[model samples]
Target chain A: MDFQLTDEQRALQETARKYAREVIRPKAAYYDETAQFPLDLIEKGFELGLLNLAVPAEYGGLGLSHLDGVIATEELAWGCAGVATSMIANDLALLPILIGGTDEQKRRFVTPFTKELKFASFGLTEPGAGSDVAGMSTTLRREGDHYVLNGQKQFITNGEHASQYTVFATTDRSKRHKGITCVVIEGRPKGMTVGKHENKMGQRASNTVTLTFEDVRVPVENRIGEEGEGFRIAMETLDNSRPLTAIVATGIARAAMEHAIDYAKQRQQFGRPIAEFQGIQFMLADMGMQIQAARLLTYQSAWMLDQGQKNTLVSSYAKSFAADMAMKVTTDAVQVFGGYGYMKEYPVEKLMRDAKLIQIYEGTSQVQRIVIARELLR
Target chain B: MKILVTAKRVEDPESKIKVKPDGTGIVQEGLKYKINPFDEIAVEEGLRLVAKHGGEVVVVSIGGKEVHEQLRHALAMGAHKAVWVNHTGPLDQMGVAGLLQKVVEKEKPDLVILGKQSIDDDQNQVGQYLAEWLGWGQATFASKAESFDSENEKNKVPALVVGADNKTVRVVREVDGGLATVECQLPAVVTTDLRLNQPRYASLPGIMKAKSKPIEELIPAGLGVDVTPKLTVTKMSAPPARKAGIKVPDVATLVEKLKTEAKVI
Candidate 1:
């Protein structure tokens, strides 16, 4: 029932806050402008232990609580959503192995993550299938002690540089969801190719591309859990990952609200500070209210995950509410900035752009609503 | 070389401090405590010395049990051990310095470092008093510090390398209008300025390890030092509000205002 963070959690939060203020917040626009991956910043984050949030202690990870991880993500996201996305993408790739992989598989794939600032990806979502996990056509055929994978994954985050991937492929398409299996693979093997890199509207610092695995031979031991369980694994991974994304969403909303608040107080019009006008004051108030609400939902969901509770419904609620609120708040922030918010020189517009992705990734807003509805009906 | 450093817990520099309604103390409802910035510099300097020379850094703090947070922070910054002396403060500069001198006698470290001043009290006298009590050469307000031939046995501090050639540490301090460089032999005291080094962030691994590192707690009474306070605070108050700026049309008016209204001619 206590809402207070432990001293360690506070320390971790303070570290991320200082880092965001010193490193990420100032460089966000430049990284966005140049549309370059922040490799050095990523290294700095690893050094600060901001990365590897999900790894186990035996693997040299902090083994941070879900709420602690969320607190960190929120601070880092406040600095720059694009930069936060790039960092969290690594954890997104690691969660699957943690959830379903064998100890050997974890030791083999997950442990090395702490050793360096390397990227890994959760390989899901094909060109033809985004929300429909069963609609994937990637296939895996059994070979001697290996599974030969043949398929393509579109909008794969960190595709170009990820050293390993927890991939999804079907052993039998006719079995639908049951046909799916989780396979962990590594490197640019002979038959694997990294396809086109995407140029996106926001979160441009986060890399995304299409990866094609043609006759890529992965060892059988790399398979996570039993056969016919990939669908459940992916859903649970989303359940865990959605809250992290929700925290980032709430961060974007808070960042936008803060900028708007600053603007309202400083930007003079009609011979007075705009904040003096109820019209602008009310907007700022509403933005603050939404940011607070989103933060509560996001933090509650993260705490639930930490408590080992079933969180599909709440996770969806958090992701959708936070994303929608961020979009609204950031747009209102632009309004507070008047014409300047529309320009690249101002930070609110970039914040607005970054806010758009939260509703899109982890699950689109529409998909989240449907999941929430089904959970309610059940 | 074995180095000892002092860490002090103070209110975060950015936090607002206001007098209590009673005027006897500060408002404590929302104050965040952090290691004094200058102490962080002292810890960083000791850590750097240990990194270059084979040695251990021990951090000591004087306060209530809560001061362990600052001590753990020093350990997380890579100090090898910590000692906590449990005591509440009303101790003036001399009493606190006497306590530290007792610790130095027990630890017998080759080098002792302290922040030149604490942000909370701004009392810049503890290190000076400690050096006087110990009869050791003291270098205060050091902005930069380096050890010579640290890797070679010939220049190793006698504490760790007895019978070796004399080892020394060179330090530059900010003196009135300029910087002063001084070199001290082994078993000396050094006080750090803000420019000594930028303290590193405690990595997550470091934080976890610090949780397990031991802190040996002691009581001031057991040490048998007179820790009675010599000063009492009768009141606390916030700084005065800033006066709003005024513009004059010409230099004549500006000069007249400076000479008359402002009384600053």
Candidate 2:
């Protein structure tokens, strides 16, 4: 089978690579250190048509294929995982609109955000819900033409800065998964409060904050799907997003591997380059192999998405494999650094920290395993 | 009033180019090509002028087969139509200028826009040659553009006034020291610089619509233009790589090194 990227795909990849090298790479460390959002870079991303890749042509989006999105995401992550995370969070927030929102909703909410480079957040995880999305306790009760929302969401990327949110809440408490419903909440609506930012170990450039909904009112038209379809919507959104997370992981791992390889050649030990050592060479080889494998799996899952195939199994496989590989590769990169790896002066430590989150967010490695098992068992 | 913008496909601005071993030209294999950066500004300026004035914008390019990408890019930037004059191999500045003259004669547009120079050659001669061929007013290295009334044509009135009263274009050009602004009447050739308006990224719909925009092709012979190179390259070679210098502990040491070791300061 031909493995080379098509001309269009290669062009997108080259564009992303140029952006990563010129813009994102320069600001990554500063944003991580200060926990400041890279708003300027986000604007640049919008200018380059990197932000809303999957939104259709009719809505003024690039309508890039899923594989194209994955390729772009990987390159961005290679520059700065945190910045990449913050930028791609819009994809997650816009998924519900792409999947189920009405034309009016799409025009009002989705189009503005994508067209104007407005940041967005997805609110599914809560104070009580982490991996268990069904355990979310947020509620939306219908009252006349509006729905009153209650409860809080935590650890939301771009939560503090997003102009809009796609929030999941319970419409019927009696039924577990069937009770969940999705709503599009405006960021500055009455009774909505953005809590203090979460100080994380890495990916700090990405703003993770808690969102409190104390009787926040949303229009009934803002409901994404049927009353009990929140669970399905959330799952389908994850099905699209898991590959994205994998792409991010692949990016981080690729960066780490590239840094390690470069270091091995330049770093001298025992009057010779460390790359000459079998141990270091072996580490580099394994890192390269894992990154390539992870990239292939991630692209395959994205290709499956573009082809309209059932990607539940492939996405789970990619997410788990790439996330776990990123963690391993970054850790190995640190090992290659020896004493320098432990200090914040070196970037591998930061990479290690950034790689950790990929395994935790979207769907945890455990959750990915469960999905894979379910698919294989069937 | 119709405006024609000339475009050239060059190596992608972001790509690093290497010269061929034969010392004649740049190595073309595996290199990415894109709409010339300066030409993009020219296209954007043309579109903006057309948008402000009630007129049509058309893009014209003379190159090999790969030049169609640049034509499509102009179309995506809101140009109404495009024309491509295909040449099999590389064309020098004179050949390109001759072909462009043919296109200008065929289109008979009121205004012609082009980049000050293509990035690959950096000759900065095509616009002047085209202006000479067309016997039109010429403005080079424009940073900003405005339409105003021509002082000489104050007493004359056209049948239709689409934009300003006299159809005069005010242009800002970068000179040796700073910027100079000049006004020229219609039927002029204006070359663009980077300070011109930033070209808009083609939206998905615009790109799709550009596929259907009419693109007419013409050969040099068909256009009655002699396409022959007026200049020959003597040699080509890569610039030497900058050497990495030793790092000092602080600025004081660096200053000391610069003063003592380098001896230039």
lDDT of 1 by residue, A246-336 (tens): 9898888888888898888888999999999998988999998988888889889989988999999999999999999999999999999
Q: Interface RMSD values for the candidates, listed in order?
A: 1.1, 4.2
What's the C-alpha lDDT at position A342 in model 1? 98
The prediction achieving the highest DockQ against the true structure is 1
> Highest lDDT: which candidate?
1
Chain A accuracy of model 1 expressed as TM-score: 0.98
- Candidate 2 TM-score, true structure as reference: 0.80
lDDT: worst 10-residue window of model 2 chain A: A6-15
Clashes of each: 0, 0
Write down the RMSD of all candidates, one decimal each: 4.0, 6.7
C-alpha lDDT values of all predictions: 0.87, 0.85
Which parts of model 2 have CA positions greater than 4 angstroms off?
Answer: A1-26, A43-50, A57-64, A100-120, A139-150, A171-175, A186-192, A214-222, A254-289, A329-349, B13-16, B19-26, B51-56, B141-185, B192-212, B228-265
